[model samples]
Target: MNVNEITPFIGLELSDASYEDLVRPEVWEQLVQGVQERELVVVRGIELTPQQQIDLAARLGEPVPFLISKYRHPEFEQIMISSNEMKDEKPIGVARVGNFWHQDSSFVADPAPYTMLHGVNVPGTSGHTKFANAADVYDRMPEEWKAKLSDRIGLHTVGKRLRIRQEHVGLSVAEFKALIDIEHPKVEHPVVCKDEYTGREYVYGSREYMDSVLGFDPNENEAFFTMLDGLIHDETHVYTHKWTPNDLVIWKTRTTYHIATEVEPGASRTVHRVSIETRRP
Candidate 1:
């Protein structure tokens, strides 16, 4: 079937399902093509062994930048993302924590191009991520909203992006800021970004953080700002992924917004994260 026919089955998946291909041509398959403008593409049910995970990523595209290991495995570059409930990976990670939604590698120049995650150890209680499709969002937005967003250029800073990360890692806000500087133009892209491949558009920007910064003005546009966030949170446009053991999902950072759910006080969710570097920045 053409992509049009398959677009409707996006969020449906069977927890026990497994697949070999990076993207299945089936309706809900993770491998999607045809559009040059879609904001996000989620492939559910790709269970890869640690080695297979690396191989599969290589097949899909080039690998993205990863954090330098103060404490790294022999194959640190290929080491998938991981974490624990109580606290693990000491010395270096004595204070390490779970990751949050922000473009990957924003700490350095030319952050990762895409982020792909695979479930390693998922506690039954809580662990999931929510994604907002920027391309679809822009397509559905009012022309005026689109115009306003287009006219404005945004500033992305490592400091602001890491706010949620700090919170998730259980670090104090003061400590978080102390570790990272709020770098300028962390990514100065448009709020409404289009998918270079699919040519689709979506609203980009961390609403909570962006609005918080726009606290630049004492009189904030709280009401209007919130309404925009509501659009992404709306059931019709949002996809909440409840991860299962062995599930592998890949999304293009350029056109997708994802929130890696931090485990509640009692639960834990762990996964391997890899970023794909693109030819463009």
Candidate 2:
């Protein structure tokens, strides 16, 4: 895999990525639009535990303190998703199986730019996460709809939005509700986020979990959430992932939306997740 010999994946525009060891330089010269050093390359082989995952993420960049959950792993609480296993051991905000989708650390002042997940002892057919192509969603937005949302920001509160699951998964009722009052700016970044290296901008956030869009009236919560959510729910613009043991997926966090696919009882799936905070933010 020579750094100069990179080629595009069928559906993906691989112009920005160069394999460090790839030797076929001619294969990649034609498609690459631009190249910004890739921050990560998924490594497969030895099973990765929480700490092991942290170590690998360290190679790409320093861990940006896991910001989503109140609980922290002594060294690092890299985002992780586990099913059937006791939820307390991992940093999943919503454990068990469910249909919830969200961005990492959006509620916090700074969110991560990338995330890495390594699957271990995965179940036969459970716990695969689906990542929607934010870019596709943004392109489909009607120009008027885009203008309406262009400058808005949304308030996201973990405890307020997913209370029951928070409690069931081990968060204390009192602690979970406390977060609802926190409001986050509903930033309308470029609808399509061009990869700094690939020049491909992807839609990274959604309205379904939005608390408010800048000036949206609080009393009209339903109208606001519904109006924008309907746009994202149109279903033609999303990607769902099914996990495989030893499989690793690293993604551009700033421009993607992901959700945990629940595992049925008597079945189990576990994953270790790590996130990198952008130096710019």
Backbone clash count for every predicted candidate, in the order shown: 18, 19
* Alpha carbon deviation, residue 269, candidate 1 (Å): 2.6
RMSD of 1: 5.8
Give the C-alpha miss distance for residue 191 in model 1, angstroms: 2.3
RMSD of each: 5.8, 6.7
* Model 1, span 80-113: residue lDDT tens: 4456523353432212333344434433445556
Query: Which tens-of-lDDT digit does each residue in 1-281 have in candidate 2?
Result: 22231122111322222233112445333322211233223333335556656755654456665544543344566654443455567433335532666666555555666777777657757666665545555666677666666655555544434535333466565644554443333334333345666565444455544455566577555664555466555555445455556655566665556677667667766666667665443
Worst 10 residues of 1 by lDDT: 1-10
TM-scores, all models, native as reference: 0.69, 0.65
Candidate that scores best on lDDT: 1
Q: What's the lDDT for all of these models?
A: 0.54, 0.51
TM-score of 1: 0.69
In TM-score terms, which candidate is top?
1
Residue 241 of model 1 has an lDDT of: 72
